[model samples]
Structures are given as C-alpha cells and as structure tokens.
Target: MIDYLFRPQLLAVVFVVVLGLLYHRRQPKPSLPDLPWLNTKEGEWFTTLRARFRSTVNYKQSIHQAYDLYSKKNQSCIIGKLNGDEIVLPVSSINWIINQPESVLSADEPHKDVLQTDYTFVHPVVVDKPLHHETIRSELTRQLGALTMDIMDELGSAFDDIWGTNTTEWREICPFETLKLIIARTSNRVFVGLPLCRNKALLEHGIGFATAVPIASSLLKLFPDFLRPLAAVLIARPNRYHTKCFSRLVRPEIERRQKLLEGQNGDLEKKLGDPEPNDFLQWSIRRAQESPYPAERDPDIIAERLLAVNFAAIHTSTFSITNVIFDLVASNPSKKYLEQIREEASSIIAADNGVWTKSGLAKMYKTDSTLRESSRLGSFLGAGLMRQVVAPDGVTAPNGTFCPYGSCVAVPTSGVHNDPEHYPDAATYNPFRFSVERESSTAESPETENDKSNANITEEYIRKANLSFVSTSPTYHPFGHGRHACPGRFFAANELKLLLAYIVLNYEFEPLTERPESKWIGTSLVPPLTATVKVRRRKQNM
Candidate 1:
C-alpha cells in the first residue's frame, strides 16, 4: 500500500486534489446580510455545503417557507442556492432594490453568473456587450407593428403543419414539445427570414443551443472557478457545437449584408429606393458593426448573438404558453370560459379586417388577462429583480440590512404574486382579473371623478397600465420590474397574444378535468413537458 501510494500518477492525483481544495478555500465568500436562514442552520463549512445541496432539491418549499415566515411579516431571510446563498428580501423592498445604482446593485452580474454566459455564449464579448438586448429593446419594439403580420402568418402555418387541419376528430398533442417547435419557427420567421427560418437544421440547432445552455450552466456552476474552463470544454461542448453550426449557417447572410452595407457606404437606409431588411439578423448585424469590439463584429459572435436571443425567447415563451394552455383549459372544465376568450379574439380580428395587428391584439383584453393570470400563478422563478452587490463596501437595504459584495438580493416574486395583500383570493386562478381591473378603470371611479389633480392622473395611469401582460410592478414581475425589466416583453406579448388568439379562433379544445401540477427544478417552475391536450379544427371560418 505504501509502495502504491508512492507511484507517480497517484502522487500527481493527490497533488491536484490538494490544489483544488486550496483554490476553493481561497475563493471569496459573500458577506451575506444579517437575516435568518430558512430550513438550514448556519454553522461550519460542512453544514453550509449540506444546506446548499439540500436547497437545490427543496428550493421550491424553502422559498415558500421563507415567504410565509419572514417575507409576509416584512422581514428578509437567507436561503441556500446551488450557485450560492441568496438574501430573499420582502416585497416591501422592491422599490428600494430597483432604485439603487447599477454600480452598487448590479442586475447583470447575477445573469452572467447564472447563465455562465462567458462559456455558454461561446465568447465573453457576447456578455460584455449585450447589444442584442438593446436591439430587442429598441429596434424590435419599434418594428413590432410591421412584424405583427409576419408573426401571425408564421403562427397560422405552424399550427396548420404541427396541429393539423383535421376538423373530423380531436387529436392528442403535447403542448410543451409542440409549442417549442412552433415558437422556435415563428420567432425565427422574424429572426432570420423565410427560407432560413424554415430551415430544419437551423431550427434544430437553435433549439439545441437553447436547451444546452441551461444544462451546461448548471453543471459549470458545480465546479470551482479554476476547474470551470476545463470542465466547460467538455460540459459546454454542445453550446460550442451549436454556436459553430449557427456561425456556418449565418456567415453567408452576414457576408451578403456586409457587402450591401459597404456598397451603400455604411448606410443601407441612406441608399435611394432600397429598403433595409427588417429582421433580427439584420438588426444584430447593424448593431454589431457599430461596436468597437472585434468579437462583437465577428460573424461567429454575431451568429451566437442570434442564438442568445433565441435562448431567451424560445423556452420562456414556450413555458408561458404551455402554462396558459393548461390554465385556460383547466379553469374552464366545461369549455365555457374559452368561448368568451375566443369571442373576444374573433371580434377583435374581424374589427381589424381579418388581419392581426398590434392594436388589434391588444384589444383582446380577456386573452391578455388569461396570460397575465397564468404568469402570476405559475412564475418560472421564485424570485425576481435579482441583483449582486458590486460596491466594495456593499449596499444597505432601506430597512437597514447589509449585503456585502458578491451577495445576491432578490424579492420574492412568486410570493408577492400570491400575497393576499396584493392579490385577493390569491390561491385561485382568476383569468380575467386584469381585464376586470381595466374595465373598472375606464368607468368613473371616485378617485378619477372627484379629483382632477396631477397626482390622481398619475394614479389612474398606473392603475390602467398595471393590467397589461407586458407591464411589471412589485406584485406582478414574471418579466421582472423597474428599468431592467425584460426588454423583449413587448415582442413576447404580441407573439403570445396572437398565438393564443389564433388557437382560440381556429381550434376547439377539450378542457382538462384537473390542472397538471407544475414541477420545480431548482429555481425554475417548469410546466409539464408531457402534458397533452385534445384539439380539433373548428368548422367555422375565421
């Protein structure tokens, strides 16, 4: 045994193990806030490690426990996480958290850490310069009016091809799996354009990349910083492969656009009688060219940006719509409520001359409310507005809790959405809650009728604005809240609303006897992937 232990390979393995231990020990630990820990006692290193692993599985329960025990009482508490421990602040601190400067409380750091974007995105430049967010926030939003018809066109074709045109019988379909493809295809129609969006290989790779990133990110976080790069080379292989596939696919388009830009002397819009393409690819190319970072301009990185946007859009919309389907069906066991939504959708579409438009989709208030209600009840994350302390000394909450550098702070999003103080009968699913609120606002209220003051105007504006699915507040933040709210929410709202409207108008769905319970995978409240619904094409014409 002594001789075997002296062997060179064995000695080398031991040496590496020692080095790893040392590296992990030297890693900076967050000076977490003075808050009571939920479900775990803070003690020695082993206890903390044990809590972290336990929390990974019990996160859903732990969050609710924290919410009830402390958050509801206006207190903060610490909860263990796979990535690290997080300070779960009360809903009252939401305004305070969002008001802080980015230097002190950074919204981007948590995202970068959680997604492990440095590796998963295929390059650091992708995370460092998130021009895609800006493009989505500005150009895509501005183009929504124009893209509405294109999105609708894709949804119709997607449903026909995937869901079928059979009016004779009801077919069982897995919503999660089917919606993923439909969303990927429909989103890509506006992302790349007609032919490429329909490319079987491209869509597969895009979906593969989206699926791989989260899995890779989760695995990468389990490793120490020193081992992550080496681990990522193996773990993030799928991400790299998909990024390469994306680069190969988009290189031709990038070259073609680059030549066009060069021919027009760096301004495609400036050229006479030539209208620039209106797609995400075009938008990203233009945005990338404006950057000084070489990686940002590289065709490979540009392609990765397209996939990054895909990663953000696909799973989120798919999950949301999946939940909406289950909620819409289960809530109306007799299928009566669906007809009300369908009538709203049909009437709105007919009023818009048989074409879906931004304004027309917006008028489907009941449809919007259904989605909003679903979001409130079935949030993907237990918490929201997550921020990492970046200031050297750390920042203090309005209630005087100190969170040092590296500590993450977030408000209980799911908890707030279900809080009785915020949402009455919070346990029940009320699909038309927001629409009712909107309708009530349009009529004369005591506040609006008796008061013509500026404060009352602001109050009325907020009251009306808060009802929309895209709008976010402390109480309703599936898309997050404050200035850092989801940039793609406007586009997501349009696409989802149109998709829901199309389904309601064109198909007849059999309501579920009971809602399928959603599962919690760490922090994500995942809708059942295998959940199926029966549907048949309606005989009536649109």
Candidate 2:
C-alpha cells in the first residue's frame, strides 16, 4: 500500500486527500479564544462563523473596514477571523515589518503563490540561486536604460500611426486598447527589437501572454493549496507557448551573434564591449553565460528570462496608462492639465532642435506629475509593500499596537494617500500638487515648517504630503521599497509620460460621463471600462 501510494500517478491523489483531511482537522472549533473587541453577541457569533469558513474572499475589504472602526475607537491592532486564518495585525504596523531584515521577514514567501502561478517559468530564473536574480535584475536595468531613447522614438511613431493627423472625427475609443498597443510596441522594441515589434501576430502573442498570466494566477488562487501545483502544471503549457515562440524567433539571432563573437575576440569580450544590447535576447544570452550556472544548463533558462521581462513590462505599463486615460476622461478638468503637458512637450522638442533625446523625454515634468497623480488615485492594488513573515518578531504599529511574529503587515496606502489629515480636501483631484510642491522648494534649502505647511496646504495636500514618495523608506511604499522596488518604474514612467504627452499634444478629449466615479474591485481601482471619450487632432496655428 505504501509502495502504491508512492507511485507518481497516486502521489498527487494521496497528497490531496491528506491535505483536505488536515484542513478539516485544523478547522477552528467552537468556544474559540475570546477576541476583546467583539462586545456584541451578534458580532462575536459572526466572527466565530468566519473563522470556521476559512475564506479570504472578502477578507481584504473587511480588514480595511475593521481598521477604520477600531482606529476611531483608539484600538491599534484587531484580531479577526479571515476565512479560517486568525489575523492579528495593527493598521500602523507596516513600517516596522518592512524595516525588518529579509532574513527575519521574507517577501519571497507571501508572494510565492501569486508569483508561482503567473511566473512559473521564471521561478527557476529567480530562485535558482542568488546569482540568477542579480543577473536578471542587472541586465534588465542596463538593457532598459540603454533602450530609453529607442523607446521614445517608437512612441512618437506609434502615436502617429494609431491616432494620426488625417483622422478628423472625434471617435469613442478604448483607452486599454490604445495603451496596450503602445506598450506592446515599446516592449517589443526591447524584447525582440525592430522588425518583429511591427509583426501583428507576434505582438498579439506578447499582449496575450501578458493578459493570460494574470488571469491564470487569479484562477489558480481558488484551488486547494495542494491542487494549485497541479493546476499550475495544467496551465503552464499555454503560458509557455509564448516562451516557445520567443525562443524559436531569437535562437537564430543568438547563433549568429555567437559565431561573430567566436570568430573574433570571443563572445565574452564582444558582449562586454557593447554590454548595453538593444535586444533583450542578446542581453539574456550574455548574462546567462556570465551566470554561475554551468553551460550544460538548458538554454530554455534564457527564454524564461525573456518571458519574465515581457510579463513585467506589458501588464504594468498597460494598466497604468489605462488608468491615466480613465482619469483624463472621468475628470474632464484634466483637459487643461493635458494642454500643459503639450506645451511642455512642444518646448522640449523645439529646445532639442526637433531631436527626441532621452534628456528631452526627462524634461516633461508636468506629464510626470500627471502620471504620478493618476497612479496615486487609481492605484491597482489596495495593499502596498507586501512582506511574508519568515520568523517571528515584535512589531509596533504606528498607533502603538503590538503584533507578534508570523503576522502579515501591509501599508494601507489608499488610506494614507487619501487621508484628510495629510491632505486637506483630500478627495479633490489636483494633478499638479507635486509640481507645486517641487516649485516651492529650492535646490539647497532645508525643508522649513513653512515649506512643509505649503506642502500640505490643502486638506488633501496634507493627507498626501505625509504619505511616502517612492524615495521614502519601505513603510510608505507605493512602488514598494528597498532594493526590490519595481526596477522597471523609471522605464514605466517614461513610457506613460511620453504616451500621454503625445496624446495631449496631438488630440482633444471630452468625457462621456458627466460625473465619472472610478470602480474599486478588490484592491484595484479601475476607471469605466466602456466610457466613451471623443477625440480629435489638435488644430495647428502656423
């Protein structure tokens, strides 16, 4: 019987049954530990039932609501039953948890399920050894940094192609589609480079891979823990289809480069001489060679890295760009802000003598502020800076509540960013708030109380002023913190800034909805999916 159970075919079945039994046995029993805050019989009974169900389906929202309730009551941390898991965390404990060393609290585990589902192929790439992560991160930074100019050039051309001058009518369009194309083009410029970026089939595959991975991840989350691994295996082939295409497409190029390097000074020196390769494939091949892994390792590892880059670049850039457009349409006041962005773009272009350089792209401060504000308001995830509890430790919440080890802590970014305490009149949309703050301060001047007051001048401003920028410590994270903060943030910002600048310079927009409210589902805040927006080319005064 033991031998039969150990067989590969029976192993998964047996494991599933054993896990289900364990889950059943571990289900919270009656006469649960008393939770101090639940004074009402109804509240206590509901809490007990929630513990028995062991579901996190509505847990995130419930946690937020609980924070508001208990926070007002002068309570810092609240112990609640989420699905079946016991959660004892303070609303203010994020800073403490994030500041702890990775050895004490690892981000690797909390995000493991999500990462494993959406990024199975790349798991080996990141977790194989320390060198793998370093190689990919370092190479990606170098490749993206060098490709900034190419990205800007492509943005200009792509803008003209999609919403060109000859089109006179203001048509209702999907911002997601427009942003999707822009991201696909820019990402492909780096991923495969040049001619392939223009290939419709390949571009479709790239976009499909980006969309599918997230959907797969969400679906995988619903299954039992043991079955998730099997589900990943079932879904991985579809995900790998794109990887297979990438490898086949780039293998010949890799071979040609290999020959050139072998014939001359050898591959290593050749790659080092021009370390900043425009093509991600070349960059990956060079880095893989330099990696500690033996050459005998499968070449698919390089393909996996390329796929990982595609996954990172496409979805994030697309979602952010879509959100910006949503805000533009929903908040019609954004038209004036768009015009300001246009003027900045026009000035930069003329100053550069009509040359689009990386420095010129960097000068679009208004565009940057607009994109940043949009991200602030239209944040895709509710929780910011997620870290897993590796070993237990004591964490003191901002409100002075204490949490023991093995507790997950998250920054209530939406709460912090939207709070009236930090930002007076917090609900109003002010696209230029950051720009105004920057303008008020000088290069060498210390931030005085007066300047800080101006920084939080409005009720809304006050709320957000105290909220951490990306440069702030891990506690106040929007793009995360520490070394693991989104490495592609600079690149993502540039792409969105350029795209928005082009649209503002070339087009005019009017909202379909009189008063558009962005929809918040789970942690993501999305603008109206089908909202109509009228657009037409800007009339030139010669």
Candidate 3:
C-alpha cells in the first residue's frame, strides 16, 4: 500500500492538491489569525481576492472598509490582503513596526517597488542611496530661518502669478492645477533659488518629472518585481529626460561652486567665492564631495538629486495646500474660520514688520493645525511606514505579532488618522483640532519665561505636544515616525505654513461644491484632481 501511494499519478495528484491549498492560504483573512475572517459575503477566498482586486480598482473605499473591520478588534496583528499577497498589518504595534531596524523591515525596498525605480524607467544616474533626503534633513532644514524671506518672496510671486491679481471677483478654478504651479515655483525658489527657479520651462519640467515618476512607477509595478529588472530592457526604456534637462539647468551653477570649493578647500567654515550659493544644487555637491563617489560634482548626478528633491517637495506640498484649501472654505461662513485665520495672519505679520519669518509661521497655529488636521484626515498614503521583513529569522512585534521573513508590513495610515479614539468626531474636518492641542499643550507644559524668550519659534513649537504640523509621533504617521520618517518634514512644515498664511491673508475662497474628496489609488491618496473653488482677491496686504 505504501508503494502504491508513491505511484507517479498519486504523487502528482498530491502535489497539485497541496499547491492549490497553499495558494488559497496565501489569500489571507480580513481579520486576525485567531478570529474567523470577517466580510464573508463573497466566501473566504473570494473575499480576499475581491478586496485585493478592489485595492487597485476602487481602492480608498475597499482599504478603509477592510481596515475598519480589522481594527474593530484592536489587535496587535491583523492579516490583510493586497494584490494577492498576504500582509501583516499591525494596529497597536505602530512604533515597533516603523522603528524596526532596516535589517529587519526594509523600507527602501518598498519605495523601489512602489516607484519602479530600476534602470528600466530611471537612468543609472538615479540615486540608489537617499542623499537627497540627507540634504533635506540636515542642510536645507537648518537654513529654513534664512530661507524664510526667499520662500515668502517666492510665495507672493507664485501666488500672484498663478492665482492672478486681476480676479477681484469670485472666479472658479481647479485647486490641484493652480496649487501645483504655486507649490512648484515656491518650492523651487528655495530648492534651486534665484534665476533657475524663475525659469518657466524649468519649473514645468519639475512638475512633469514629479508627475511622471509615480505614473511610471505604477506602470512598471504592473509587472512583478523580478520581471521589472528584465522588463526595464523592453518596457522601461530608462528615460533620462529629466536628468538631461535639469543637468543643463544647474551644470553651470555646480561648475562655479566646484571652482569656488577647489579654491577654498582648507576649511568648510571659511567663506568661499560668492558666499557658497545657498541652494539644493550646491548642497548636493558639498555632500557628494564628502562621500566616496568619484562623480562628486558631476552635473548629471547633481540634477538627479535635484529632481528627487523637486519630486518630493512639489508633490506633497501641492496636495497639502489643496487639501487645506478645500477644508478652509468647506465650513459654514458663520464658523468664521477663514475670517479668524485672516485676522491671525494679519496680526502676526503686522508685528513682524510685514515679513514672513520662520518664527512668525510658528505663531500661525490655527493655520498649522488646519494643515495637520487636513493631513490627518487624508494622509498621503493609506498605509505609511511600509516595511518588508528582510531578515531570515523575521521579527516579532512588541505585542507579540510575528511576521515571517519576506512578509510585507505597514501601519494603516488612514485607519490610524480616522480612529475615533484619537480624533473625536473623526469623520468631520476639524481644522482647529491640533490648534486646541497646541493651546492645551502650552498650558500643561508651561515653559520658563527665559526658556520661552531664548528658544527659537521653530524649536518652541516642536517642543510643545500636538501643535506642530510636522510633529512626528506614534499616533501621527503622516510624515511617518522615527529615523525613516520623511526627513524633509521640517522644511515641508515651513513651506506649507507660509503658503497657507499668504493665501488666507490675501484671498477669499468659496467652495463650488461639497468638500472635495481625494483620489485613492492602491495605498496612495491624491488630492482630488480637480476641485473648483471660487476665489476673489482680498484688498488687504500685511
């Protein structure tokens, strides 16, 4: 009988049966391990497949529904399905998951996967390491106080140019397109600075590249990861368009900086020729010189780095501005939210000799909170702090949720942001939620008078709990958390606050429709592609 069981046909049948079972098992449950899967209307396997299919199809509703179901248990570990793969989503284990060393849960790989950033789509010159993030985290952020005037100047010019000065009447316009121009120009002013930012064609390419990176990534991801490398040969085409364009834009600047640096190689503290141009391109060159790469001042390399910064800065800032725009005028006119913000911006700028300051932006807590709350309502991605278990041993969560090696894990950003436990009346848009948090935080943790006077406004705002637009905490994962969190958030905070302050103080907006809902594709939440907000110029100037 044992020999009979080992017959060729019998063994083949068993192999087929086992393969089917394993495939079905990988479909995952819509609930935790110990619990029977919920959403049983379509049967176990069908529910999983349907949800995964809907993930790419009608995404936002599907993920939110699935997450809501799984989160009801408030379990440390819950199983979810995405694109036919079982995922380990931790609700209560956010800190442990996000803070995991890169060895255990690799964040970079997820970005590569999401961005489809292989030689196929991006050139070899495209960054393998996150040098741009380093530049943003350290150099650019430290200079925000100094760059405030530049951003304000850019903000004023970009808004005036994009929103138009002649529209004294309530003219309707799409928020995304309008804000994209405003954000691109405002961001590039600080990014490349001066004449480069003023180039209309260059700014347009920045927008194009920013938009193309994700679209290309999404298209490439349509192919499996293993195939992506091979696919890049045929499907990807290794587009170096942005690299070529931006390289020309900044090559002269980088060459001048290199010459200046060569002359003043003795010490970094020493003033170099032209005061060492304070912009992203210059910073990239300085960092590259510090690194081991031979192509330290290579214009193409510098442009790739610049493109990365533009992509990050323009994409996030535009949507954030749009979201806040919708939220600002969404409420009843009597709530007087817009009026209050106008009053605040006018009062703050009046005191600052009519100039935007890093410190002055800090006092715009209502504006800051509106940005934060808008972000909290609709985070950039549905799942943030994504990681994949890379270690062979695999790691266990703080709450004892274990993920096997090679498993994908992430915090449900949408779920966390909307949790009623964290935000009361979670469904509603409460711009002042974080503002109140700021005030209550101020009262609970009073600083010494000397401490208050000595601390910079940026430091003071961050020191308080719940006030900062860029505050990174376990509860708030919009910018993510820990070391892997968005390194550019400080600059992002300043950019957003200043832009919104300028808008609220200078314009009046009325929504043409209900609060505009963002577009959801897979895990990403894009601000509605088109939201027509009626706008009129405010006659007052700070």
lDDT of 1 by residue, 339-431 (tens): 898889888878988878877776677988988989888899987899999999888887778888889998777777888888889998888
Q: What tens digits encode model 3's per-residue C-alpha lDDT throughout 92-146?
A: 6776676678888898877766776665235444556767777887889889899
Q: List per-prediction Cα lDDT, in the order shown.
A: 0.84, 0.58, 0.70
Evaluated against the true structure, the overall lDDT of model 3 is 0.70
State the lDDT of candidate 2 residue by residue for 1-542, as single tens digits: 11222347544544564556567557543322223432124545566445433324443454455456654354543334322233334445555555678876667655554555434553454433434345445665555446767877787777667766654677666777776787788777866677777777667666666666765565455455556666566545456666667666656666666555554445455655754345666665666655576651345555555566677787777777777776665665635766676788889878988765656765565666677677776666565665555554544455555444555545555665566665567677667655665434333221445775454356554433333122333223567766667666666666676667767767787654664556765345555555546677778611
Taking every candidate in turn, the Cα RMSD to the unseen true structure, in Å, is 5.8, 7.4, 9.0
Considering every candidate listed, which one attains the maximal TM-score? Answer: 1
**Alpha carbon deviation, residue 418, candidate 3 (Å):** 1.1
Q: What TM-score would every model get versus the actual structure?
A: 0.91, 0.78, 0.85
Q: Which stretches of candidate 2 lie over 4 Å from their true place?
A: 1-63, 70-92, 127-146, 235-237, 263-276, 295-297, 332-335, 392-407, 440-476, 515-517, 539-542
**In model 3, what lDDT does residue 369 have?**
84
Output the better candidate (1/2) by lDDT. Answer: 1
Task: Identify the leading candidate in terms of lDDT.
Answer: 1
Show where candidate 1 strays beyond 4 Å.
1-23, 41-46, 266-274, 443-461
